[model samples]
Target: MSKDDLKEAEALGRDLMWILGLIMHSGPEDRQRIALAYNQAQELVASIPKDNGDARPRIVACFERSDTYKAADDVACAGWLLTGMQERVNERDLPDWRKLRKIINNTVKMLTPPKPTIH
Candidate 1:
């Protein structure tokens, strides 16, 4: 990858981190904006070249894992799980990171409000 590619990836990483922070904190009323940001981050990751290296894939996986947990009904538990996963990543424990990602992703399913039907 060229210098520009690396730079773009770094920027995307920052944006994704910020979006994740927002999503974890935002209320249900703010779902639309959070979802939009989430989609944009996914697009950014998708636009990066796959052959660049494993970095892109790893980063994408992190986001994908977090996404899986976004559906979790227990907000507190999901928040704690996310925090622990973040810590594992910070410690560079690849094995734990991978495992936590799967656990978090598989555990949560966002609770969506019901839509109104015509009478």
Candidate 2:
């Protein structure tokens, strides 16, 4: 991936971590919202094309992390996955790194729920 794209993906990963932290500390009702958001994000991820062979190992690691996320009932899946994406970008010089980074970053965005508005 280009330097800019990698930076953006890193930023998204940080945001996902912060959001997951908030959800973890919040009440059950808020956690429910986050869970719903995660469900929606699964659909979004399914629609994204991420067929990068170079990043396969990282993707596999992320899948394992995702299993831990689900086991712990945590919304930290995006954070874990983003970390994998960032690593892939740093470790590989694949021609399609840009597309891969974009897909991963978009998944992070989809995993993030909109902030609740206060009246």
Candidate 3:
């Protein structure tokens, strides 16, 4: 990949991290944004050139969403690491930054589910 491609990938990584941040947040707005970012990140991850090893399967396994405790742990750990790295990339304001940020912010807002109000 050229320097530009590498930079683009890093920017995507940052957006992915922000999405993770949205996922963990209980806020309504951020929740939607997170969901959008999460989907986008998944798509981006899918697009990366496939290399040797079982990393792809393993990453997909994390998203499998099974009832098993081990499965949950795998997903959590892998997702956390990827998301964290993505955030670092996002901080740099690399290419494709605007669209990435906008989508993540919007998705986080959309992801919020209804909650009971305190009387």
How many clashing pairs per prediction, in order?
A: 4, 0, 16
Instruction: Estimate candidate 2's alpha-carbon lDDT, on a 0 to 1 scale.
Output: 0.56
- lDDT: worst 10-residue window of model 2: 40-49
Q: Cα lDDT for residue 94, model 2?
A: 49
Could you give candidate 3's per-residue lDDT for residues 23-51 as a string of tens digits?
Answer: 56545454444444455555655555435
Candidate 2 per-residue C-alpha lDDT over 69-100 given as tens digits, one digit per residue, 9 for 90 to 100 = 75887765545555555555554464556655
Order of the predicted models by TM-score, top scorer first: 1, 2, 3
lDDT for position 100 in model 1:
42
Question: Per-residue lDDT tens digits of candidate 1, residues 9-76?
Answer: 45434543554565556688555543444354445555655554444453545456555656554223
Judge candidate 2 at residue 49 and give its lDDT. Answer: 51
Candidate numbers, best lDDT first, in rank order: 2, 3, 1
Model 2 ranges off by over 4 Å: 44-119
Q: On a 0 to 100 scale, what is the lDDT of residue 46 in model 3?
A: 58
